[model samples]
Target: MAITHFTSSNSFQGYHITQQFDFCSGFGQFIDEDGNPASFSMAKERAMQQMLRAVPTEANAIIGFRVEHSIGSYVHSDYNNCILTNLITCVLVSGTPVRMEKDMEQKMEKVLLVMDYPPALPIRPYLVTLIPGQNESTLVQLRFFSYTSEPISALQADIVLRTVFGEDIVLPDIGFARIRAQDGEHQTGFFRVNLSDSLFSAQSASVRIKKYVCGSALREGDVHNQRIDMRLEDLFDLKRLYGNDAVAPHVVYEGGWQCLCGAQNPTDEKTCPYCQRGGESRQVAHASLLRQAEELHSACEILACLQAYEAEHKGSLPLTFMEGLEKMASTERMFGNMKKECMKFLHEHLEAEEAAAPADVPDLSEEDQAAMGSDAEIPILTPNPTGDGDTAAPETEEDRFTIKSPFDDPYWK
Candidate 1:
């Protein structure tokens, strides 16, 4: 009889069973990165466990199975953040709970789903550039590499800038979901947004993607976020004295442009006090060297050593950093002559160790082995090679209660 035609007087119990699980909830309202309900598998497992207990004690499995799960959203107050939507997973199943033959086995092929989310974001942020805006504002754009078609939502970042003179400005909560100058195939997801109300007098900016959030996932930007903060070629030493051929030159700054190196120099000393190079010559060479350093380090990535070193130290570069960079410049000259001698010693030591390799096995005496019970004979049971699960072993001359091989178990063939 159909389930719809069933009556309360004639209840169906042994033929089938249904289990309903309590609602399960996870952290986020939307599906996870793999596009799966976060707690579906968990709830389904719980329902299956409950059904197994409610079925007849003699039943081995539920054959005609039907498992169901769904997602739902509801607004609720969360202690961690503002009011947010809660995603829930509910599961239920109905099946014919029956006891199968002891030797039963299904040969049908089944497919299981596996998913991987190698990267949290579909696009990798490559570069962020800022320029003058149309209405006395700042226009910022973020260039990114898009390898997947998945859409990223609620993408926001925090950018810092330097205004004219020496004032700093921060543009937090900036949106970069707008597609501009983007080619998903050849180029990337170039995102742009006009800061309608920005620092109009900002001359040059120092931009880095220090913080960003994608969807509901909180992630920190990589150190390479400053791919092009402020190009060295565009830098200007702008406090010119008189525009004559040589009537005073270079920016007349109070602290000077040696990354604030010469702090001991007089307040009026625009440049280093001990430098011999002319003002114009040193400024131009320093700017050129910066560009060359950036270009060279892009390929070798040697500059990352200092950046990582600084982070490891948890503050500015150590005193050893400046002293070591200057002293280690000629380390090749100091170590060049010792290479041959060091290699020869290393080779000889390696060969000696190889020639005198130690044996791995133990070398215990025969009498010691016998005393330790190593020579005792151990009885082993042989598995029945060719027989159905119902086949019984012939009566053995040994004890009747002797342990049997795992293959002889009633559940096995």
Candidate 2:
């Protein structure tokens, strides 16, 4: 996990010359237990193996490598059900490529693995409010943990809810716990229980955790139990324990200047002079096209276009805005100005929507609000053009335009 004798000093001439390079590869299908296409975690070990190969054979070590991964999903109709399958996983790795001194010794130390018991209860409770009506409902989220020293093969639990009025609601067989043994981490699962209006009116509720099974045996025989009183005031204080900061940013599209046929037209030009697609229809078409463009371009292509632009313009934008846009369009299939405009449009749209909503409707918590305002945007997914369930490598033309030697490039030197 640690690298010794590796310094990031740009003036270190004694060491081998270093240049940055991009490496991309694909691995694994995104299939769930039920054969549905779902996003799944790519094992760390498998990802590491792919990254190791990214370093050239001539290089002694890889330093300051950063990785970005994305899963592409493809949907198709099958037997009246829409089936989603993992199209491909794109792994993009970038780092300072270098050769180490022959005499320098490198060593890796052994580390001990530690295992511990999982938490018995949720770190905190989450409250969700249903619509205000006769069949009004409320969701109470619960987190369960494992009792065994070893990682549990599977776990299941039943929860019994008793109201102050002596009414009992039993929920059985609630958890799916199949954590890996080598992971050495206890299983933590979340289960949500829906309570009707009558249940929510109860003065107090008791939760009994029963039939606690782990790894083929009952770990706890009705031992874990908790009781909580439902408050009328707290009903209005719905809060999400986890924030949406991790969610991808929404990408917006703006249309006016660029034409459908890739022609550079002024904003005043309401219609694309070449394609004849213009006005409101053109704007909608342009947004869809931009999303398609975003999907077609890979990270490598964007990085290449960015590097090429910087190299030619002395770290400044091109003399003609459209010229720089053209370069980006060639690689990324979209221009920087377009993306910026799209972001601005998205912001205004969200603000307008929020302003128009009725005040009585409860707003998301502060954390959730902040996450929505964050600058980060999610990666746009596009249909795979290859149709082979593999991400195509960056075109050779991109590689040809890049600086080949570190000594010649000011950034690398």
Taking all chains together, each candidate's TM-score versus the true structure is: 0.21, 0.19
Q: Which digits, one per residue and each the tens of the lDDT, describe model 2 over residues 1-413? A: 22233333432435554444444332433333354333345433355566556656665555565556676655666786967563555555445556555422322211111111112422111111111221232333232222233334333444444445777666565543322221122222223344545544333223344433343565654444322222322221111100110011112235335432233456676553433444344233324333443443343443345446457657343245335444444554453234444333333443344355433223458987787576733222122232121222222664322312211223212
Query: Model 2 misses residue 377 by how many Å?
Result: 31
Give the Cα lDDT of each candidate.
0.37, 0.36
**Candidate 2 residue runs with Cα over 4 Å from true position:** 1-141, 145-147, 162-167, 172-195, 202-205, 213-220, 223-413
lDDT of each residue in 47-134, candidate 1, tens digit only: 7666555665554444446666677776666688777666666677656544433322322211111011112223334233444433
CA shift of 273, model 2, Å:
79
Rate residue 327 of model 1 by lDDT.
41
